[model samples]
Target: MKKFRKIGVAAVGVLTLTALVSGCGTANTTNSTPSSSAPVPTGNAGTTGKLEIFSWWTGVASSKALKALIHVFNEKYPHVQVINEAVAGGAGSNAHAVLASRMTNNNPPGTFQVHAGNGSLYSWVQAGDLDSLNNLYQSQGWLNKYPKSLLNLITFNGNIYAVPVDMQRANVLWYNPSIFKKYNLTPPTTFSQFFQDAKVLKAHGITPLALANHGNWETTLLFSDVLLGTVGYTDYNKLLHGQMSWNSPGVVQAANTFTKMMQYTNSDASALHWQQADQLVANGQAAMNVMGDWAQGYFKTTLNLTPGKDFGWAPTPGTQGVFSVVSDVFALPSKLSASQKAVALNFLKVLGSAEGQKVFNPLKGTFSPRLDANPSDYDAYSQAAMKSYQKDQLTLCIGQGAVNPGFTTAFENAMAIFVTNHNTKQFIQSIENAAQTNPLS
Candidate 1:
């Protein structure tokens, strides 16, 4: 998917058109938000068959969410068995690769979890390796609930591709509440103030930003947040679209800001995955971690801490308000039995249905994509995300969301080298060199 705000108009236009072709052409904008206004649950048809589901989810809460959805799917199809095939490691490389291999071997799962957007999963769907969910989507009236902005990401060539399971609000700052109390520091609302607070925390021997750059993508998070905060969304998009060169002053500034964060982070951040870094904050070894809502699930399932009392959530303090997102979506794989296809489509509908979103998204510690879904009882940090989303002011991560997988890596690689070496000049050149030129009409 092209991250909405990342690439400039050219890339954005290309992606938007690509989506219109793949996810479905123009999405209708007259839909109402899926709030409490939804109709009372009425009986939907049930199935009595079996289908296998596969995803890269390995966390307890992740599994719980998937299982809950499966349970609901079973309520309709009591005899239908939803088999789960999940494995860990390599940031979904292993699971995705296995699924790709399976596709060739003729044993692909009925449905598979994937990242949202036309840039990532569109190829497989376009290859006729996945089933079109357009018929099912329209039959169930999902368009009226999910909205064109959200649903359009899954729509392609006038056909919908997948059901989004969860939306991760990226670039959030989760701070330890107690640590703030100890230092008498309130979470600052601006980047400048935030940095000042970080200096204070550093004086007292605290790592202000929970950073682990091992997977390398973690560094991309910091760069994305900085670019969004400093350069403004327009230039950030241009940078990703290759309209603006990496040698621009904005990239230079964002890189410097990232270097400042490194100074305040744990020295071991180089070896940490985002999870391990979050653990540092949960365990009080660190004061903050800038990540997405998924970390909220990690804290709940792994550390078992209360959100508001233990930690406070804040967005990457940049302009008045801006948002960043990453969503977990599932596409129907090709080569499904008729019943399996039915099950897959039915499962997707359930995923977006009011109940499916409520049970699954909350458990996953993510916000529901359905517009009207309330994040009732969500911990403090997550509600902060809702505030951002509702404002429609969030910016998407440029490199990851705007660039394709191949190009996304090029950006990540440039960021990793920059973060480690703290080299502004070299980093700017690297990004300029790595960005793939894409022109739009």
Candidate 2:
């Protein structure tokens, strides 16, 4: 979540994306034409090198998914040794900082984890630090597999910078099904209903909403969803892309709505991490938690719970038909040695391949970015999310990787302050000042 491409008004056009439910066909690498200077091995003939895979995937589920992906890569290229350089932190906060230091010091990793879209990928491209993967996309037959909007996020100046492995929906309301059933409540679809549900649950001594803001991004993410819900998709896009003013009535209303919702959250939210907050819902101490689909991995894999049975999901209240997308992508540094570049690009090929997506997405609690990924490979909740992503109006998550780093930092700073104060007027003024100072492009 460092910084990436700019998905402004022009980039937002393709966000109303069509579903990526296509047939599962094999990926063909017949068109791969490696440059003479940096010769890429079409096959694993003499591939032997150390590939440092850098990411912030040290969590149980994510680490397993990373291993699975590496296993696949290793199977094809047995000679290449993979170095897992995973740093622990929520939202790549620490890893990206380390990565930035390494990159600036000309000690770039073979490939690094980056959120796709108007995030860190764009910043890298702007600084000429990343190599375009257009050739790899073509060779892997992935040009038409992903959504145009998704591809647009990683593309700058007609060149693609990253390979998105999976897509996470940020606008998900994860709830304890048994708790709801015991309370004779259903999943809320609108803010009013959510409040009513929260009130009922709170009356029964339950934490109505579980929130974690240890790094402050969680609250910002929640606010982003609230903004989308209050303003609707069109205006939401307008607001995030700088086309609409931050001081707009919709933004103020959204801020107010976010504040109201915060009343139902746990008092200890500031002290908890996301997983701890999620555990509250899982342990039945909390009724609901609004988080990204990655929570599914925790519930299913780590907690050994079943989707739809142990837990239930719906769009965050009033955010129905809107998919707030946050994708994890990998990119190669432009300055790697030719041999290192070859190995890194090979890893990228695997990352972008249909085989790689199918293998990694399910375990990671996300769906593949590829259109050709089979729905049967996923769970009940994922299937539903897949359908929603296909049909829903796709909006980017602000706290994730949807804007310039400067604007993102300002926006996050404003959110951190707003979460504590809950002053709507001050929040609006702060954000307006941020947008002006950072210039949201």
Q: Candidate 1, overall lDDT?
A: 0.69
Q: Tell me the whole-model lDDT of each prediction, alpha carbons only.
A: 0.69, 0.81
Number of the top TM-score candidate? 2
Candidate 1 runs further than 4 Å off: 1-49, 399-402, 437-441
Clashing pairs in 2: 3-119, 3-120, 4-119, 4-120, 4-121, 4-122, 5-118, 5-122
lDDT (10s digit) by residue, model 1, range 340-401: 76666677778878888888877788878666677674666667676666555434474443
Locate the minimum summed-lDDT window of 10 residues in model 1: 32-41
What is candidate 1's TM-score against the reference?
A: 0.85
